[model samples]
Target: MTVEEVVSMVSLIEELEAREAAARVRVEELESQIAELMARLEAERETWSRLRVTRETVAEVVAEMSVPDTAGEPGPEEPAEPAPVRVVGAVMVPHWREGLLVDALPDVYRDIVEVVADASTPMQAKQIVPRIGLPAVTAKIEGTPGKLKRLVERGWLTEDQPGLFALAHRATVESGEGAER
Candidate 1:
């Protein structure tokens, strides 16, 4: 059209182009920041996971050691206090009687209970399968979910959420307070 109109349009175009380039640079910076934060988050998660596993393993070892070798006869008498119960992961397990408690469970229920008890958070049945070192095929079996549900019903475990499980109170299970169900 006119020279003046063409010049004005060119100026507008250059301004818009500069803004678009600045926006693109900003978007790239934000993307890079997000990627860095995600990497940090993953590293922190791995560290926390390792710490939780170590804590659980130490608790288990301590529990094993606390059980006395009661098989020997005729020792000098000092009135012994009951063993203390301690938190293992998120569950209360007796420092001396974990083995006895596990032994009291039915064969099918023991592994599942142990996995839930040792977890630092509540677990779903699907999650429990791998943690218990069961075959992936076992998760597909209907009985797996049913067994977990039965444990909840029996108060050996608690359903923390609709499908997530955790250990029930140690005293309730150990004292036979919840055994009637």
Candidate 2:
């Protein structure tokens, strides 16, 4: 073989090896980036899971608190005890029953019931807002509907038609003339 041809072949082989080494370095960098992104994705998924669990736990606690404990019953001869009062950080209306009174409700909820009971006709949330001592602003008016709906769900109030709230007929009859009015 000619020396010149041999030298040319050796130079071409060295150039190919240099290109291969550069490609390997680029592949390593991309692999590192992929690994980092995977770890970040895992962290985000864990955070999402924790938030969902926390929300579920809070809902469970709130549901359990909705019904006050009535474990100890008084003897028939003993004077009937007054219903236990439920003091809560947030508004919680207990389901109205034969024995439960408006007084058993939290202050805001009782105020809402009293306002509904006193009204001559079924009232809208906007109309009832001012009477409950809240300002007749958009925000206050907007927030009242949820409370009104919750009352209906708990049987303390009724919504025979949409957006019109009234004291439930059964609640009135059970609690006597005051609630009926």
Candidate 1 local Cα displacement, residue 84, angstroms: 2.2
| Residue-by-residue lDDT tens digits, candidate 1, 1-181 | 9999999999999999999999999999999999999999889867876776576557556755765655556356822443454544533343223324554564557777867767889888778777667776642433367667756765678786888888875653445433432
Which lDDT value does model 2 have at 130? 95
Cα lDDT tens digits for candidate 2, 1-181: 9999999999999999999999999999999999999899789867866775566446436855654455678568644554543444434466777767787676677778888888889999999899989999976786678778878988889999999999985464346444432
Clashing pairs in 2: none
Quote the lDDT for 127 in model 1: 82
TM-score for all models, in order of appearance: 0.46, 0.51
lDDT of 1: 0.66
